[model samples]
Target: MAESGQDQTKYLKGPDQIIPSDVLKTWEPMGAVKLKMTKSGVDANPPISVPSLLRRAADKFPDVKALCVKRDGAWKSITYREYFAKVCTLAKAFIKLGLERFHGVCILGFNSPEWFISDLAAIFAGGFACGIYTTNSPEACEHCAISSRAQIFVVENQKQLDKVLEIRERLPDLKAIIQYIGKPTSAGVLSWDDVMALGEKEPEEQLDYRLSCIAANQCCTLIFTSGTTGPPKGVMLSHDNMTWTAHANSVNIDFALGKEVVISFLPLSHVAAQMSDMYMCMYSGVSVYFAQPDALKGSLAATMKEVRPTVLLSVPRVWEKIYEKLMEVGKSTKGMKKSVATWAKSIGSEICERRQKQDFGKPVLYPIANKILFKKIKKALGLDRCKIFISAAAPISNEILRYFHSINVPLTEIYGMSESCGPHTVGVETAFKIGSCGRTPPGFYTKLLDKDKDGNGEICMNGRHISMGYLHMEGETHEAIDDEGWLHTGDIGHLDLDNFLFITGRIKELIVTAGGENVAPVIIEETLKGELPCIGNCMLIGDRRKFLSALLTMKTDMDMDTGEPMGTLQPLALDWCKSVGSQAKTTRDILEGPDEKVMRAIQAGIDRTNSKAISNAQRIQKWQILPKDFSIPGGELGPTMKVKRSFVAEKYSDIIERLYDV
Candidate 1:
């Protein structure tokens, strides 16, 4: 794939790097208002670079444990001083290996210490870091690398390295490929050990000079979109964007400095995880523990039990799985155990309700409930020490929220896109409501545009936390951010009387019916899922059709090794089937046998959902269940489990057409 005889000298220059002219050209006018607010003022935070934040954190908590990684059946700790020292060393090593300024240092892997080090070192060396999702194909990886003009590419293991090696020659700007987890088999590739050795041999003079030239306003990272609508566009984020947002998040959550602990398992490629696991931890001096690579699959609970973190952030699917498992276990209880659990749950729910209303007075049975049920449940889930639980990326069902609340774990919702640097609004302990995205945090402003009769409009945000526009996509960037610096999030939502933001739907996902009525499918889909315990996923389809219909997937077991959905129904789903007097053991069994009981139950759920529809257009008139559940490997869900609505619609066009045809 190599273009023979191409000049590589420019990329191999020493550490006296300046932000490239092409990269500078990508910076749009961030608007006069934004610039004004960015300047030091009485109410604004002084702009700080990420490198500066890390240095301060190291100085303040030199001996405090900052990172924990499991190796050889044991957890190993790295202190703040050591973490800072290693980052500086890696930065110097990148310079020695000819990393260019403003270019990308692309990392591909699961969450790990090496991934964290690679990300920060790239920024510290005056280059922007880009994380490629582990689920991305080789072509997708090449797209991000080429778009950013990446020079140094780091991967976690052989699998990721192989993806790069297959396309390495085409990456004309690439200077080195470093494999962090294991030794590289390819010629001229560097191992993680080689990087450290290079750092040890390199002098500190040039690295220090490079660090001095760093600025807060320059782009330091690129977060690629999930590409559901089209190809992924790199969202450029400035150092100030990361640092300020981290500080704001810490304040919003009331993070305890050097005391807050978190599990790092979510895909780091996403802005939410990067801001939380990496930047927020540095800003707050919080300790981070790396979960196993398969944390999402099954091992996360073990990690949680071991670490017992104080802060937890997850996408809704994780919480749903936990809830489902708890319910499955609860179903098996008999006699006295069942009676006590039922009583305890009621008491817990009552206590939580009182707490939400600012009443600390516990129900008379609260002590007994806490001792008999709540405490044990929290301990089993390894959330006994958890003080904050945040759910983001997508809307979580209120049923799941209420279920957790009843168990003494309230899930707080945070809302934002990558363009807003992860969070523009967050639910805090004192002001959160179920299904609400919470209030805009300090240092950010939210406004609604083009309001309908109901007061719902497109959500817009303006703040120091907003990103520096998309890279190399000026037209798209302009469409997203207006002249006043408001990032026009295409999401439809409204601020309540108390300023809590409730997301209704997305403009792009709106299913306009043939009757000339606009329909938001998410509310209907969520409502349908809430009515059907056996259903794993639901996608409402009928854009420009006569009426709404849905494509449903029954909750089926998954092949954990391959991350593919299996035909057999999940235990929760089987229990649900049994409750409906159906003996179906698999999705195939239910569909092929045309199980009257199961089919009737599903139809009843649809009828119940339709009964509450706001309009006839929003009602589900017909629906069909798919043979398998949605999964990451199945191309139905994204990395964080957000449904790829467009993709799903396209994939099921035949079935949707059949529904309309009939």
Candidate 2:
């Protein structure tokens, strides 16, 4: 990748960073708005401590409840003073336990006061904090623990603690396990209370100076990217990376999330949900209503009703589910409901398109449909009070975007990853393009690398938001970043004539057709996913064959109309036997049960889908869907849920041979 500088602004500078002309054009407007608003003292640092943010907000509104920790089925308040004391105690204990500056520490648990506290304590104690997703398999968890070489880990309960212990022998650096929430772990383990006891024995002294070793530019958080391709790699992010993330969000949209209620339902492990739900909530002093882990929809609505959250963040999969539900309801209705739903979708798409025409006014709407259909949809999703809905992690379909837009929900599309510290680019309804991602985020310099005449190239950027580097992978870092210090993002996209970005596909995810045509899987995946939410994902499987085929997984429904589990809660073998004509479409050779009904159904789906594909890239034959779901342990997936294509191909070579031979 060739890195070049085309400077327009003298203010933004780096090794090879340049201020895009489009960025310079909006500098004045951004400056005016930034100048008019005061920068929050939330990010004060020699330490870049997040606890400092809570303290600042607490000082402003001391009586205002800082955090409401729910436990024993009762809502309890942790006032500012109490919260600070708890954090300080944890920080002191961590110091007493040999946690020093820049040491990697892991937080392995669900979202709780302790999770947040441990994260703050680690940063305050001057170590990089890593948050691992709770749902990660034992192997996935061990991979992260080993990768980071984390000396200290803070877990919530025994199950989490046991998972650590199971992998403890593999991770020699794992010295201590701190239980923040739940009953004290087994007698053999040193509990969180034991650490607190150490702090209780010492008198408080020199709080600020002890944390002086940490700097604003120092590595703060090392988040693991859910590796779609291979092993999960750690993204080293500085304090500035996190701070600029909050600033970028504030600058681009009118999402005054700080002063309103916000809900935390997403996994704090992911950057999109974490940055918005955790970092943003902490800095803004927003009331966060965390829902129960199992009760997503019910708890979501309950939390929404209780807190009346004005800010929301979700992935497109969730939106797709809701959109499908809404359509199902509309389809089931007679005249008015169907018309209302249809009109709402139409008007929403129209309003979204008009905003692209540079019109900035109240969105035109059919008031009756807006109130009855759109408004109701918003309330049902617990998004009535929300000023904006931000979607990321994956590409959202334009149809889904328009569906929510019609209901007066402004769908803001954001693009970034853990490597970016958080999202670096986002779109507001007013400035967004339907199919395009959006303009460059604030505090980042974006440009296309290796572009041809039409300016399509791999997207690269340099800014405060850029990650520090890959943890313990200098060679990979050298491969990813160039000599000029730009992160060569593997995404392919172009800046349109209007300066909005339209992502074409991933450079790495391209497939070659039998006719020697280069086709992008991401484009086809997005299109197919948009069309059929029920068809989980489609893998276009033609490289040098006469045509292409696909392996399909179905969108599962846990609860049915009867309010019971959709599939057999019995044994996997029994379930497989029963789900004969169900969603069992996968590679043929990997098939498990008797070949009576399922074989016919799988073959039928493949045949129907093949008719849609052209001659050289069409499915000629296939096999039954694999009985196992993809995972590291299952040997079908990477840690980040990306299919292990080569592994799968090799594993089912026998079946693939039969299918092709015939």
Candidate 3:
């Protein structure tokens, strides 16, 4: 067994070794010195560009498996050399197709090896790649393509091809559409093989020369924001921005070279997945296995079992679902099994608490508990080999975090945005705070703007990882990144004495009551969701209103935990429904009209949440359960499953107004 001390030491670097002396001196005046930065323990260095990293990885680990994807019911792989050759071939093809330096090529797809190849190909061709979410509507897709002025668009399948074709006439700059999976069905639509054939005809010297001339500051990708508040803006990330992120994350996360395995499941369009999985894999020579886009949820367990990945990175929702499943199984056990499970969890929680306090003293039963329970639980979750399990893209519930810790899964939360290349701060196993999102990473400096009484303010970041700016939106770019170089994140947070970051809420999402009280709705909403099993999403609505009200959405047909059909309410939810005098036979039945009993049950949940509120002003007075839950396909939720606040409020204005009508 690995000693806990040694395990922690492998990932944690001393604070003094992270920041360069000259850079520290430069930011000392602005109080940036107080913030924590990742320590590379090396001198200031220029990051290797994306293409260079790919070439180096191929040269270093030529025969090693670099990419894997499921094909025809089997997992197929490509070696580092083969992957590099494919990227080069696509790069040459793009150049042959008249793609000029700094021009844009848009890739619309789910996570796939081909997506990575195309992304790298564009960069290697001395052009930039724009990633559009697969869930984006036709108009949204067209907007991103037009905004980025992409010359070529790559679609995943027939559906995406149709969307692109629907807006084809609107996109005059779009020279061609490349379908990755299926045969070309229409004019102007090309097959993957066609592009490769084109590349085969082009001179290798031309492709190599183009790659060699690529500069660190040159734009490599245009990642569009989720646009929960407004139309999505294309964030222009340079080669320097991406490569620096890869290098910094590699050091910060202790990415083991050649030995680490990663399952690429999240949308590659998101910066988190792109940086952590694709770019980091390239930088560290980690083998990556691609998960099927459609089967991600159902096949995750099978994939995890097969891959046995050493590092796992995911959004909060994935962790929450895992926690729910574990709890469901624990609750289903009986008699001796139940008692043993309960006792094991108790021991695990106690050990976790002790470890958090740096108490290494071993209790008599510690070894026994690990042997009998904790190890088994880790193995069951397919995380026995995982050294680091990260949750990012959005804030996770502290309750979920504690529950995972109790079962021997220590989930670390990281914080960042597209503007900062997906990670600004990250909690390390050695020095993790329960609710804080660690400290700023190396090469970045963070500060707070418009601090409140408690020092909570808009989190601002200035760093090498920060993107150049939004593409073609000069005014918006100026507003986001100031002359001083700080990119205003618009996220409300505060730094602790140790410089650990605690994100509270978004500046735009804050709720203000007519009574002159400012409320951070996220805390209240999270509290309600944590307290109610049936609740899927909770939105606090009372901006300029007399008091706070809420719009609650219930979970759907399937049991959130077990994934079993809730033909009727599940046991716990059934009890609540009975208390409310609800005769609803199914989960859908209750959500349809939500009888008085259901309303009472929901009100009881609200009351419990109110009891935990800091002040009466923050308490939710009245709430109406919505008929359906917010979802990515519904345009009410972002790709990461975060609520699109503006869209939700505007879409349900009538329902929200009725809550406070009295």
Error of 2 at 571 (Å): 24
* Candidate maximizing lDDT: 1
Q: What is the per-residue lDDT of model 3 for residues 216-317, given as tens digits with 9 covering 90 to 100?
A: 554678889997768998787867678777888898888888889999988888899899888889888899998767534466877887878888988887
lDDT of 1 by residue, 1-662 (tens): 11113332333332222223222223431211123244444226776788888998999989889989999999999998999989999999999989977789999999988898889999888888999999999999999998888999999988888899999989999999999987788898899998998998899887876777665666789999999999999998888788888988887778998888999999999999999999999988999999999898889988999899999999999998999999989988999999999988888678667766767787887888989988999999999999898899998999998888788786789999899889889987677878899888777899999999999999999887887788878898888887667889999998888788999999999989999899988888889899998899999888888888889999987887888899999898998899999999998899896899999999999999999998877888888899888899988999999999888888888888999995
lDDT of each: 0.85, 0.62, 0.78
User: Mind giving the per-residue lDDT tens digits that candidate 2 earns over 313-411?
Assistant: 776655665676666666557887676677766776666667878765544556755776767777776777778677777777787787677666778
- Evaluated at residue 6, the lDDT of candidate 3 is 22
Point to the candidate with the largest TM-score.
1
Q: Alpha carbon lDDT of residue 328, candidate 1?
A: 89
Query: Which residues of candidate 3, in runs, are more than 4 Å off?
Result: 1-43, 360-362, 558-585, 591-597
Greater-TM-score candidate between 2 and 3: 3
| Candidate 2 regions with alpha-carbon error over 4 angstroms | 1-54, 79-82, 206-209, 295-302, 362-365, 452-455, 513-516, 531-533, 544-546, 559-659
Which 10-residue span in candidate 1 carries the lowest summed lDDT?
A: 24-33
Error in Å for residue 197 of model 3: 2.1
* TM-scores for the candidates: 0.94, 0.80, 0.90
